[model samples]
Target: MVTKEVRLQSTVAGLTADGRVHTLSVWFILALRLMMGLAFFQSGLDKVLSGEFGAGGYLTGAVPDSGSPAADLFVAMGNTPWFVDFVNVAVPWGELLIGLGLLFGAFTRLAAFWGAFMMLLFYLGNWDVAHGYINGDFAYMLVFLSVAAFGAGRILGLDTYIEGYEIDGQPLVERYPWTRYILG
Candidate 1:
């Protein structure tokens, strides 16, 4: 029942209204995203280039040689041979994928989730060695987790579009009780 002219006017009004809240500084967002993405991407690339495919083998003898805490665990796990080999193939590639996703802002939220997850595992691994206490491991993990929690991509990545579309068409996911706290 709406006329074309009326629809056009409403569209313009909606865009103007949305523009107010979409005033996130583009340069700042790009810088944050680029820096974070580059850090992840480079790490992933290094893992592959260094032949640390799964990061398992690297964890094993690589640590004990440096007198690391998980020496026993790594040595024991490395003895598995098969498991270490599997990790060598899978983990490094996973890092590469995660890095690429973040660097390109392809799936910012998902990349952040994976990056945070990786940080969690790394932190746990370090904790197992350190036996708990103030350590940089946990702190780094928290930082990545914080990014995921806030949906950092919303600042300048594809997440902005994703959020906008969702905000416009379907508010269901955003309305979830825990989504706000998690996705911020």
Candidate 2:
């Protein structure tokens, strides 16, 4: 057997960083995608089936009580009648769609982007400085980003097929480079 390594490099603020990842780590990447997918799917399914998922109380009461820095924004959103209605529909449906995308590895990057965004919001809303700023929600957000960055969908995922589909005798990614943002 041969060991495989993936070299990664990045530059930010004139600082360069580089690292190598073991190919065997792919399993963990896939695991992260599946775990989040299942968790979000189950949570969304329950919310949809129960038809009792309302963000108003939590956004206004819980967020404010939690002393989150963004409490005012959340309360504002909760107070807006139209926004609340939108949230009533968006939260469950968004979670369901995001979960499905991640589970099947279709539109994986797009799904992960939304998942990260949601996690960021969750982190802010559930803020607790008692144990430092980092929390599960923040960690989950990073995981979603990692999934996107690693293109986890390309491993035994529909995105692989989708990206390879032919268009004008060219691969999808080659034909539509912008799709890279959402695919993979």
Candidate 3:
């Protein structure tokens, strides 16, 4: 087997960093995508099937009790009847759609973006700094971001075909450059 090396470089705040990635890293990236997809899909499916996933109590009670910095905001959202209603529907449906997108590698970046956002909220809402600042939610959020940055969808994913689809003698991505944000 041939070994391929991918060189990565980035500079932030006058600091430079670089690394080399082996081709074998692709499998791990794919695994992260599939793992998140399955976990979110199952969680959403259970919530949908049970028809009893309410965020109000946790937002108002648990968040405050956990001493999260965003407790006030969470409580405010919980107190709002309309917002609670919206959350009820949004949480399950959003997870379902996001999971589907990741699972099929369709609109993967979009899905990962939302997934990361959800994980951020979970990180804040759950608010457990007992051991340290880092937790599963934080780790999951980073994973989602990594998946998007790596364009994991291109690896045996529908995004590859979708991006290459012809449109007016040009590929879809070529026709609409903005698609790069969401397609991969």
Cα-based lDDT at residue 178, candidate 2: 95
lDDT of 1 by residue, 1-184 (tens): 6423221122454564222223334454555556667777787778889874555555764656756555677677777878777767666676677666656655665666777777665654555444555466566556556566445666645555544445446763464434443232
lDDT, candidate 2, 1-184, per-residue tens: 8776678999999999999887778899999999998888988898899999999999999999999999999999999999999999989988998899999998999999999999999999998889999899999999999999989898778999999999989999999999999988
Clash pairs detected, candidate 1: 53-88, 54-87, 54-88
TM-score of 3: 0.96
Candidate 1 structure, TM-score to reference: 0.57
In model 1, how large is the Cα lDDT of residue 44? 72
Q: List the global CA lDDT of all models.
A: 0.59, 0.93, 0.93
Q: How do the residues 62-172 of candidate 3 rate in per-residue lDDT, one tens digit apiece? A: 999998999999999999999999999999989988888888888999999999999999999999999999999999999999989999888788999999999989999
Off by over 4 Å in 3: 1-4
lDDT of 2 at 132: 93
Error of 3 at 15 (Å): 1.3
